[model samples]
Target: MLKENKYCCEDHVDMAFDDFLVEKETFPCLEKSEDSKCSYCNKKAEYVLKLPS
Candidate 1:
């Protein structure tokens, strides 16, 4: 079951699903950036998973 949307860190503050898509689309090279750390664990977000709504 899906629980409430949970963010691991403040970087994802107020970010919606669409926002994630837009960010991914707009910044395709973010994966190579040092600042692209995971909002929860501070690890690198090497991949993005799109869950069904």
Candidate 2:
């Protein structure tokens, strides 16, 4: 898997999820990382978004 994107809030999660779902068509693995920023915002990321490689 690859850390495709990072999300700080649920609002931004849906867009990433939809893109992932369309690309992979499966549930993704989740993780949390340190010092990572949200892919769609300036806030620090709370959830690590992984996409199957």
Q: Per-residue alpha-carbon lDDT of model 2 for 1-53, expressed as tens digits?
A: 64555454455777767766776678777777577777777677777667655
Q: Candidate 1 — number of clashing residue pairs?
A: 2
Off by over 4 Å in 2: 1-10
lDDT of 1 at 17: 40
Deviation in Å, model 2, residue 51 alpha carbon: 2.9
- Total backbone clashes of candidate 2, pairs 3 or more residues apart or in separate chains: 0
Candidate 1 lDDT over 1-53, as tens digits, reads: 43222232344433534455554443221212333455457765443333334
- Lowest lDDT block of 10, candidate 1: 26-35
